[model samples]
Target: MNDADLVDNLTALESLLQVTFHDRTLLRRAITHHSCCPDTAVHDSYDTLEFLGDAIISAHVVEYIYRTHPDASEGEMTAVKSEVVSRRVLAQVGQQLGLFPFICVDIANLRTFNERSRDSLCADVLEAIVGAIHIDQGTEVAREFVTRTVFPMIELVSTHAIDTNPKGRLQKVVLQRTGHLPRYRVLEQSGRHNDRVFLVGVFEQEQLIATGKASSIKEAGRLAAREALQLLQKKDKRSSADDTTA
Candidate 1:
């Protein structure tokens, strides 16, 4: 995209984020997905910025949580941090900011855009934005951005929200109820570098219960586990009803 277009998009993002980067170039870099320009030598992408931003975001969240909840124990702070930094949380934040429309992607591969998952892109863009803000302005400004924009959205999400960490939750629930843990096995993997998709199956005691597909193996596994848990819950309810009838 040209400078004018970049400026306009950044302006829109600023309105959405409620903060403006002093160096608009940083903001431009943040939104430039790798798929938009595979040749790094030709055009900038968000990967490097994402790496830096990830650290900055993590540190800021930890500091904020530590200070805000002084009386809360370390475990509580850890849980809050986990919730805040989760991929699911970041994707939600990105969606709220309408970042998807502004993503720099390959025009030729538009079909892939529709078919593939958007969560990774959204999370990457969110981190890249944080890195851009930190570089364009300063850590304090970036921290403020996190506090005002990101934190509020995360907080508004219900605490009793269904556990997004389905794999862990499923394992715990299974162990508690049946004294057995769920297992995940990769069923298939496809696509080329930077756009691969994984299919995973979740099993309990050699019984294949659920399967899912995603861009990443972990994501696919989690989804499969979630489906398996749901199926198991339904089975349990049916068993209870049969017992009552008898």
Candidate 2:
């Protein structure tokens, strides 16, 4: 878009964000991908802004989790915090704001913008916008923006929370991948029944995927499931990389 059109679009984005843009240039830069504008070194894209946004959002999220869930265990708080700040979830949040249509990337890079990576682009721009807000309005305004915009996303994500039942998630993933369910077996038990340590192995058909040790069979199973999830995530990344190379 020309500068005039870009300014007009920025005005609309400012309206959407409910923030008055004291400097529209930052917002313009935030929406731009390095491929689109290779004017500056390294930061012509929103990479630096995205980095700043990551830290700012993290700090506010930490405070928000601590204050809002005061009675929650450290594990519980960490689970929620991790999910809220995750790239996937952040992309979902950006999608909810209808940002995909507004993002600016090099025309040449348009071929790479599939539904999956488009969401990633949205996430990056969302963080860049947060960074821009911090620079323009200061920390308090940035905190307020995140608190207002991001807090509701917590509920949206919690409704579909995966950490609540890693075993169930693992089973579903395994079933989809292999058309077979995973089986869990207790490898060993130690100590008294009340204070026992259980070793568990999770297997897909006859092939073992991972093992875990916990205070109970159920907890051990969950730990195994969590490990399986990580393994699956790594596998997915590898698959995606292969596809890109192909």
- Per-candidate alpha-carbon RMSD to the true structure: 15.6, 15.7
In the range 2-100, model 1's lDDT, one tens digit per residue, is 878777887998888778767777777788877677777134898988888889888988876665444335765678788788888888778777789
Report the CA-based lDDT of candidate 1 relative to the real structure: 0.76
Candidate 2, 130-186: lDDT as tens digits? 999999999988988898878887655533454677777787778877999999999
| Candidate 1 root-mean-square deviation in Å | 15.6
Candidate 2 TM-score versus the reference: 0.63
Kindly report which residue pairs in candidate 1 clash with one another: none
Report model 1's TM-score to 2 decimal places.
0.58
Tell me the whole-model lDDT of each prediction, alpha carbons only.
0.76, 0.82
Q: Highest TM-score: which candidate?
A: 2
